[model samples]
Target: MRTLTFFNHKGGVGKTTLTVNVADALADQGLRVLMIDADPQCNLTAFYLDEKKLDALLGESDDADGGTLWSAIKPVVDGKGGIKPVDAYKIKNGLYLCPGDVLLADYEEELPAAWTGSFARKGRDYDVMCALSAAAREMGQRYEVDLVIYDIGPNVGPLNRAILLDSDFFCTPVAADLFSLRALSTVGRAVARWITDWKTVRGLASAESRDKLLHGLPTYLGYVTSAYKVSSGRISTRPHDYWESKIAPRVKNRVVDVLRAVDPTTVPFPSNKLAAIKDFHSLAPQAQEYGLAIGKLRTHVNSGYNAQILEAATEFSGLATIIRKRMGI
Candidate 1:
């Protein structure tokens, strides 16, 4: 299965929002999509389900349920088992979600312990790292998923390190701001460090031990500029210049290229401009409140708003189309 992650070390870049919408968009195209919410905040899960429903799935404390991504991997953290059978929640046709849990953050502290365990070729560390991968593979096969989309929290900790390592590709969603630009450089260096450290651990492990662990780098699949205005297929507003002239190139030269500094061979990366997702303005808040994609807001909007709805259809669809091409999904 092709596994991809939508990640940015900085938050407020619409990562979770874009993730759910993208999953829905892909589902609309008759492709099976599984969204694994690895963020401890559980925001992605909250989008698709209510607290009452989620409570039923999670049940009580000490439950070994795999209804959430945390429940699936929590056993590994507790030294009880490997990844449990992840019970993904169906959010309508062709779209599924392995929800996130707030309590998932509880396991974050043990990541350093798990890191040390890797040196002795232990199963716990490998098991924790590959938990999501195992879930993705099993669910992808069960659902015949076209792609597995992971929505993870913004961090360079052991948690994200493990998740990203197991993923095949990573695409960042960036806000058109200098903070986002600065974050790219930091994320780039952190990603390189993760890859290098994984290799060192892998080298120390025996063949049998290595077989249980996840190693190597996830390819950088370029970035999408979000929270930006668009007019007639070009960036709109004054900040548009910053995004076009500065943010986009920095993502390429500063982030993607810097992350690949270990490789001696030079290869030009793919165009960093995937698609500029429009800010969607008032439509976004209304859409989120109603749990609808920007493109699907027509069902909830008045007849006077057709033009804006149409714009959303074009924008979100173009995003799905371009990203699908990049992923061969």
Candidate 2:
């Protein structure tokens, strides 16, 4: 299965919302999709599960067991064993969710030491570094999924570094604002360095460990511009257009160009803008409340929301198609 991650260091960019809905849309198109909530915030998990179910999975209830992403990798983090098998929650016919845990933040503490020991080709350190990827692959194979999408927290932390390295492709979800524009350079520079560093470490690893290592080269799929207001069928406000106009040039200069300079072979896409997602407004909260995708929200609401529901369905469907085409799926 192909792995894709939706990431942006800037918060409040609707990254989790976009990831969940897009996975739902892909599932609707008959693809078996598995979503990994790698974010410690657990927002993606909360989106699909109610509080009681979430409490159980997160180990806050009497029925708690090994069902979360953290549960799978905890053994490796503690230097006890390889990753344990995790039973992903089936959200619908074709969509599944590997629940996230607030305890995931604790894994970050071990990463710094593992990263250092990796230079010496320490076997345990390699195991720790590759734990998440190995677990994800095992789960993907077990489920026979067509696509695996990861929803990571907003940061350039060690945990996120490992996730980005393991991913086959990544897309940035950004808002039409100054903060999102400024974040492009930070993400670009950090990823380039990580790729370079990973290459060095791979050469230092033993043959066996080298075979298990991914290339650490996640191709840029492009950016999704979200949370902008829409008129009849287009952007309504002048302020929104002004910021939107700035996105392409900034992304090209700050992100695409920087990445190309590091490894031209990895930069094959011609464009940086993937899709312009119109603001979902009321539909977002309604969908979240019911733990449903915007397209599926129609069944939970009255006739007055038919038009907005249709618009949401069309928007996410188009985004899913673009993503599939870009990935050559």
Candidate 3:
């Protein structure tokens, strides 16, 4: 199975929206999909299941027994050797969730232990870094899944470092604004550094040992721009001018160019026109309320929303198709 992480160092770029809804789109195509909420905030979980269900699913438990993602890697934090898979909810026939929790913050402090010389030389850092991916892999195989998508928090912390390295590839969600444009640069350079740094550490590991656990970092899988207004099914005039004149070029320079500079083998990202996406009016809230996808809201909600829902569905279906083709999945 292939793994993809929907991420951006900048928040509020509709990262979770794309991550969750894209999973829906793929599932609708009969692909077995698994979504892991790696963000401590647990926004994806809240979006799909709501607070009432979260309380029921991941009720109070000790660190050792928390049904959230923390359970899977708690052994690593306790200095154990490897990770085990955790329980996930089957949201539908083809989609599942390894839910998230606010208590996940409790484990973030555990990641810093990797900084020690002992952890690096022993390859324990790699194991801890790969805990989520390892679990996802095992779960994917068990369920015969086609894709695993991760919804990650916006940060440069060690937790994110691990998640990035584990995924097969990542696509960023940007808002077509200055902050997100700058974040595109930040994510690009930081990813390059982490990839090289982990490579060096892996090289130092004992040859022929089973404990050298570091896997190579994921490659860039282009990006998506969300919440932009569209006219005639194209980016609206005002936002298009600002984006075309400033943001798009900077992303080409910072994100695409930066990755290529670090590793010329890095795949060139798609154009801004392909990446820019529109927000469908009245879709998000309806999806959250009904546990539905933006693409499915037309059937679940009133017929009056038919046109708007079709626009959202077509957008994600096209986006998912491009992603699958580009990533060779």
Report every candidate's CA lDDT. Answer: 0.76, 0.86, 0.74
Relative to the true structure, candidate 3 reaches a TM of 0.89
Clashes of 3: 0
lDDT of 3 by residue, 143-190 (tens): 888898988899878778777877778887878566777787788888
| Candidate 3 or 2, higher lDDT | 2
Give TM per candidate: 0.90, 0.94, 0.89
**Which structure among the candidates has the greatest TM-score?**
2
Output the number of the lDDT-best candidate: 2
lDDT of 2 by residue, 1-329 (tens): 89999888999888888888899999988889999999999999999899988987787411225788888888888877888888988999889998898888888888888888888888888888888888888898899998999999889999999999998889988887767889988888888888889989999988888998766888899999975544357755666568778888888888788889888866688887888887777888899999998888877988899898898888899999889888888
lDDT for each residue of candidate 1 in 19-100, tens digit (9 for 90 to 100): 8788788889878898888888877777767678767765653475446766666677777876677667777889888777
The parts of candidate 2 lying over 4 Å away from their true place are 60-64, 229-239
Which residue pairs show collisions in model 1? none
Report the alpha-carbon TM-score of model 1 versus the true structure: 0.90
* Deviating ranges (above 4 Å) for candidate 1: 58-61, 227-239, 264-268
| Model 3 regions lying over 4 Å from their true place | 61-65, 115-119, 209-212, 229-237, 268-274
Q: Measured by TM-score, how close is model 2 to the native structure?
A: 0.94
